[model samples]
Target chain A: MNKTQFSKFVEYLLKNNNVIAPQYNVEAKLIIAELKKTSDFYMGTELPLDSWKWFLLPPKQKMFDYKGEKMTEALPSVKKQIFLGVSILDMQALTLLNQIFEQDPYYQEIKKNTIIIGTSHMPKDNFSEYFAKFEENKLEHLQFDIFLAVQNGGYKIYTGSEDGQRFLDNFKYKDYKHVEYAGPIREEGLDLQMVSVMDGMQNFHDQKIWDDLGKRCISCGKCTIACPTCFCFRMFDKSHLEQGSGERNRCWDSCFYNEFTQVAGVAPSAPKHRLMATTAQKIYFWYEHHFVRTPGTYSLPGCVECGRCTRACPADIDIFQTQRDILAARNKKKEK
Target chain B: MINDYQTHNCKILKVESESSDSKIFTLSLPYKDFSFEAGQYVMASLPGFGEAPFSINSYFNEKKFIQLTIRKVGVLTSEINKKKKGDIIGIRGPYGNSFPIGIAKGKNVLIVAGGIAIEPVRPIILDAVNNPQKYKKVFIFYGCRDESAMLYVKEYPSWKKACDLNVALDNPKSKKYIKGPVTILFDVVNIPTDSIAYVCGPPIMYKFVLAKMLEKGFRPENIFISLERHMDCAQGVCQHCAIGTKYVCKDGPVFSYAELKDFKTWLSPI
Candidate 1:
């Protein structure tokens, strides 16, 4: 558990390669940028919506390119990526993602070559409850590689990974003088914003709550689009009628809309409000109860709380607040 | 790409348009001994249009050809309906669990179907008719909207002769129609508690019909209902069709009423 000053490590990365991080104000407000000049640059609080999801699974990347009878695999090559400002939720999701991709039928290509660079948060957002769960400490899972804990004077860098160790071994840092302040300290934050979506899912079958919520929905699919873990998509075959031009493309699909279930020609139900209802229900439903594995295992609910869904939403529905409302409504229903 | 999933060039040998949109197409493939069980399904494929899974409407014993009574509901089935003899096609497994004919042996069997779900029940109807000594008694309660929606009209007489048949169309007033809903037949039939009932239909039909069967004293374990799922991969790899942890493609397309006992609501497997 040898520690080194974080400045020494940041200096090393700046000298050799590109490093991305959210700069913090003296009061620790988030500034969206990598430290370009590093003249008194500090790490920010919670990470953005754009975390490591795309680093492994890129949105709209070709799964397999087919040429007539021939097909080519779009496998990603290994690269060294240093993600900055990782919250507890991000770290937890990373650990979960590693387990899934490394399961029996290994999704070997993505897992083989990726390392995460996590930063300790100073609790800017009120949602940093993960600190309380495991005694305000971070655990190394398969996904996250290096963790840089920022102390008041400097940083205590825990080189937990081989890749991290190798990078630090050759590089220089300040001193581990701030190690005392930098170690695990408890701050009563909300533990993983986990709604026992299980209990909620059980009660809300055909609940009238969706009736009001659906009216607020615009069906623009902003929620699914902004969700880091919404990997559900649909396939489309676009070819010329003469059978000459042939192209198959699958795009991100949202169940919150009518077209998602349009079989043959007629869709079974209304697409717009119903999709919102379905999406709301699916997320709130008792997914983990039935499956031995949690539904979140598939890189979903790993949302970094970017709130892009709120911004992109024309309906101006705050998803975070609505999610809480759902849990509360579920509880009320249970009591009834 | 094709190992366990091998493709066989198949074609629609004959098609009987039973109604406006519903057509029972008899198909021919090169392979012999294409043995399927009652209530099992096969994937029919057409080049450039991809493939669609259809229930085995024909008897499972046939090695020569396959039968699918498809209602033109989607793009695939619409294109499939247009397919005729010599049209190039492909087929995969008779994937999934089927109706338990052996389970019904020595017990009075009641088969109930609503809408197009009867397509899957067609083969079972044949099995019950051809093999009478295997079961003590057999009855099929088929329900539809009208004469236009009723399928396999030509084969109805033979089904009646083979076993008891109750046809319930929505329009009982018309001369071509029968009175009362198929659900009412459960009340009319003198099925004892020991009888095994099979119900297949839309969710609404299953809700009401299953209740009637239960009310009539058929135990949950003794009743089976086929489930429809949002199938992506017919293989278990795709969890699209999951109901709880059970994959409809693998664990069942047909589950006992007891299986539905725990599913709070019929939701796709996450």
Candidate 2:
């Protein structure tokens, strides 16, 4: 299809459903928000300031409702939403979230009602070679509704799910081919970069690197907010003015915060009990979650390497540099 | 799909004061045929207050009810402590892997717990009590800050009938109890090196007790330790209780020393 058909397709989607696409805000910064018009869509190589998690896994979600000792499950009541102009890197992040929250009803409620339309547009500073260049074969490994592969004049379309095919069929477009949804694993097994970094962080102990990061990191947790796959959350309860009424809620939490690992103890009188007390320990934990824990649990690369964390860091803590340092420390240990 | 976070309302059957800071609340089974294994815990909560994981302190074989020994440390526990009999509280779980009772059946059982950590291991102790022939021998080493801090004092005589019970206090008021930390009990007692040891304690106690156990010829694989962490979702989705790749909420609140030794962040972050 040419540019005219694509614009017509967007117009059809916007008439009924809520269309979320990358667009320039008032500050001229690219962000993923509700697209009011087809002219506002910005399908550039630059990633948005906020990730797609804000839509799927909201910053704060209500999990349960309680009233007078009775508790009921409060799953998110989401509307039919379409995510357009999603980069391949963010697709990987969404695929990973799908696996991680496979059993989560709250996440599934939002996910089931949503449509993901991926694009072949690669970010300028992309680090993951697996997604550096989009290929037809990579579509099976990713979870999406529709994919718009940028070609000479317009876009080549592929349908990944029944929803995608139905959406295209409803638009009276039938030029797209269907791609079967295979699992997240590639035919060649785990990515080499993911394996090496996971091994380096898990096996090699480098205190100096964490110490340096600890000193530089202010622990504001902007990196966690910006990253696509950072989904750590803490559950809480909010009370209403009426007695015995409230909701059980969960919000995104960062490992950098002191309260992340805090436990119950006699605070003032006794020494506080916290798992990660020092900034070095907390920073190491943050890295360990991305490099070691995620890969070990899901067999997928935790850091999609969109360079969002690097850009979001106020302390100029480059995650790519940290990976290099971890690998260097492992190599030095091997030489001995 | 079933909502994993959904909780069932459990009626508080009875409440008994265990110590100055803690109480034992017996609750009706969340559902019919509700059962749990030793070392497993439940996410207990009240309406306005938040939820927290508490180990089921009753015998796993108890079909009618389960017990939780909650310490008045945080907002949730303090609220739970205020609850009386017939009060309803939301509970979900029986989460995490249990102690290796099958592997420990024919072998001697060794239990070492500090302060309130003994709650999780109470089911195992009750098992040993009810079935004396199930294991060769059962020995318990419990350490506390003082006499007032010791738990299950009323049941000590019943436990002593089925196992070798040793109590240690940091500030013992009399000669009836042993002195120093629980590690000192290792010096006086002669436990078989081959015994399957289950340990649960404060973070500080693990270093000393594990070193003592390792020095005493116990195998790493034979020792199981219960770790504590602040948990939100007991389904392992929440990252609060994660230790390395393992989620302590699901993978374990109890783990063998062999499995835990590999992760440097198990005890604390690297």
Candidate 3:
């Protein structure tokens, strides 16, 4: 399909669904938002400021509603939505989220009514070797509705799901190949970079590195907000004006906050029972979650290596540098 | 798709004061065939307040109702304490892996608890009391701040009939209990090193109790410990109760020492 055909396809999708695509905001900053026109769409290698998670898993979601001792599950009421111009890196993040929240009804409700269209556009500063170079074979490992492999003039269309194939067929376009949805694991096994970093953080203990990071990190948690795969959340209850009425909500929570690990009965008069008391411990937890816990749990890389966290950090705490430090520490220990 | 966060409304059947700051509330089973094992907990909540995890202190075999001995600790528990009989509260789960009762069967059982940490282990104690012949011997070592902080005092007579029950207090007003931390009772009593030990306490108590157990020639694999953490979703999706790769809410609130020893962040964060 040529550039003219792709514009017509976008127009067809916008007729019945809310099209979310990468576009330049008023500030000229690239971000993922609702696309009003085909001209507003910015298809480039540069990553948007925010990820597509805010669409699938909202920042604050209502889990349940309560009234006079009765509680009912509050699944999200969603409309048909299409995510266009999604980079391959963010696709990996979405795939991981799909696995993590497979049993979550709230996430599933929004996911069922949504369509994902991925592109082969690789970010300029991409650090992940797994996604550095996009290939037709890589599409088998990724989860998406449709994928556009950028070619000479337009794109070589590939359909990952039946929805993608139907969407294209309905647009009166059939020049597309359908790719089966392969499992998350690659045929070769776990990625070497993910394993090495996980081993480095778990087996190789370096206090100096974390302590240095602790000093530099302000615990502002900007990195968590920016990172695509950071899905830590806390459940809370909000009361309405009427008695015995409210909703149970889960909002995005960051591990950098003091209250993240805080338990009940934590008063000055009572004993101090906080697990992550110091900034260093909290920072280590944040890294450990990405490098160690996620891989161990899901057999998937936690950090997508998007460098969004590094860009969002106010303290200039470089995640890539920290990972290098962890690797260096592991190598030094191995030598001994 | 099943909503994992969905909670069931359970009516409070009975409320009895256990200690100065705690009360035991018996609640009707949330659903039919709702069964739970020892060391498991339920996410108890009330509207307008929040939710918190509480150990299911009731006997595992009881079909009629479940009991939760909630101590007035934080905002949620304070609200829970105010609830009376006939009041309804939201509850979900019997989440997390239970104690290794099968492994402990036919072996000498040693139960150690400190303060309110004894709540989760009450089912195990009750099991030993009911069967008595299931294990070779059962010994309970409970430590508290004072007499006022002691729990399950009324059940002491029945428990003592089936097992060796020893009580220790930090500050004792009378000669009813030993005058020291629970670890001191380790020296006072001659428990067999070959026994299966179950321990639950404040984070500080684990260090001393583990040291004392190790000193007593107990094997790491033979001991099971229950860890406490601030939990939100009992389904393990929430990261609050995460320790290393394990979600304490899902993988465990109870874990064997052998499994826990490998995790550096089990007791505290690295």
The TM-score values for the models, in the order shown, are 0.71, 0.98, 0.98
lDDT of 2 at B110: 96
Compared with the true structure, the alpha-carbon lDDT of candidate 1 equals 0.59
Those runs of model 2 whose alpha carbons end farther than 4 Å from true positions after fitting are: A266-271
Residue pairs with backbone overlap in model 2: none
When only the first chain is scored, the TM-scores of the models are: 0.67, 0.97, 0.97
Error of 1 at B78 (Å): 1.7
RMSD of each: 7.0, 1.3, 1.3
All candidates in order of lDDT, best leading:
3, 2, 1
Q: What is the lDDT of candidate 2?
A: 0.91
DockQ (Cα-based) for each candidate: 0.18, 0.71, 0.69
lDDT of 1 at A50: 47
Model 3 ranges off by over 4 Å: A266-272
lDDT of 2 by residue, A253-300 (tens): 998898999887742245558999888888888888888888888988
The TM-score obtained by model 1 is 0.71
Which CAPRI tier for candidate 2?
medium
